[model samples]
Target: MGWIGETVDSIKSLQIRQVLTQTVSLGMIVTSALIIWKALMCITGSESPVVVVLSGSMEPGFKRGDILFLHMSTDPIRAGEIVVFNVDGREIPIVHRVIKVHERQDTGEVDVLTKGDNNYGDDRLLYAQGQLWLQRHHIMGRAVGFLPYVGWVTIIMTEKPIIKYILIGALGLLVVTSKE
Candidate 1:
């Protein structure tokens, strides 16, 4: 009991000023990241301003590990626009190009069909089971630009469990041990 208290007291009393300085520095770094993410959301007009391609569904045009920039506009979604969408029960989002659009006059709503560039058929299988078409609500954003092979780091980390852990551990260690 005496040794534990003495040890803790030594640590807590020593380097108190330096510890607070590093702690505040780390907080600023984390806050800066959040601010940058929010700024991207505002500037791109998309909830997810950037996305990493996880599958090769959109090959030739976009391969796995490619990074895409998205922008949402009030204009109606048009055929040929590559968009990211979410379906009920799916954990990950899907990126595909719009193939068809059915506009309803009564409600002014749009029903869309999407297809992958490398796929043999439209994205019927990717949609919610038994659901025929994707409504505007499923769409997250439209692809405005892309950077090829940039997201391989994310893909590799996802594919290899240990790499993900190591990367995360390294980041945590860096944050914890960094002086500034």
Candidate 2:
């Protein structure tokens, strides 16, 4: 009876140690991801250094489900350059081509007009009410590089949240069950 009780206590301690190890491992992984994201933000000088294209507005150049790498630089913006911007009332950001740029001589600020490649008209209608042009502050970053069709995973997860939850659960299960 005494030996059996000793065995039970040893087993409980081993289980607790395994759970703690898994929890620490999960924390380390999350911390590493955050560090990498902060490093990218510092390197690119953009709040969002990577964005997934969610629309087909810029078809033939940037299709849906594409992954775009953004870079915010000090160079002057020019016509025909692709940019991602946010509107005053809208939550999602838009990606479009710069059709026109009007630099004000008095303030040195520029009024930027943008249009989607597949759209018939400029983006004035899409802008906030009473606003005709996008300012420098509205611009998030310019498209520097892209990966074709790489953003489909993100799109699928966003469109179907169930899959996202299932994926997270599976990862947690694996981490907890992993022997090594």
Candidate 3:
């Protein structure tokens, strides 16, 4: 009986150590992800180097759940180029294609008008009140690349908090139970 009790105590101690190791490993994984995101931001010169498309307004070119890679550069924005921009009062950024570009001769500032491929009209109604065009400051980045449907995970995690928590719990459990 005494030997059995000692063995049980050792098992409990080993389980605790395994849990702690797994927790640290999970922390390291999250930290590495953050580091990679920051590196992409720096390299692309965009505040958001990657964004998940949340709307179908740009369908046929970009669809919902697509992951867009953005790049900010000094090159002039031209007509037909896709861009992401934030509205004055809107929290979500919008992705659309430039339909018109009006360059100011006096200040060299460019004013751009955008339209969604699936929409019949331009994006004037989406803009802020009394605003007609999107200035350079309003633009965040231009779409450089995209991965189709890859962002569905992000959308699912965002829309279903319980599923996200369950996934995290399951991953932690797997790590804690996994034997070397």
Residue range 1-180, candidate 1, lDDT tens digits: 999999788667657777777778778988999999999999988999999998888888898889999998888999999999999999899999999999999998999999999899998887878999999889999999989999999888778989999887898768766665
Q: Estimate each model's TM-score.
A: 0.84, 0.89, 0.88
* lDDT per residue as tens, model 3, 1-180: 999999778668786667678788878998999999999999999999999999999998888999999999999999999999999999999999999999988998999999999999999999999999999999999999999999999999999999999999998777766765
| lDDT of every model, 2 decimals | 0.90, 0.92, 0.94
Ranking, TM-score, top scorer first = 2, 3, 1
Question: Between 1 and 2, whose lDDT is larger?
Answer: 2
- The worst-scoring run of ten residues by lDDT in candidate 1 lies at 171-180
| Per-residue error (Å), model 3, residue 64 | 1.1
Candidate 1 vs candidate 3: which has greater TM-score?
A: 3
Clashes of 3: 0
> Which clashing pairs does model 3 show?
none
Clashes of 2: 0
Evaluate residue 52 in candidate 2 and report its C-alpha lDDT on the 0 to 100 scale. Answer: 93
Off by over 4 Å in 2: 1-15
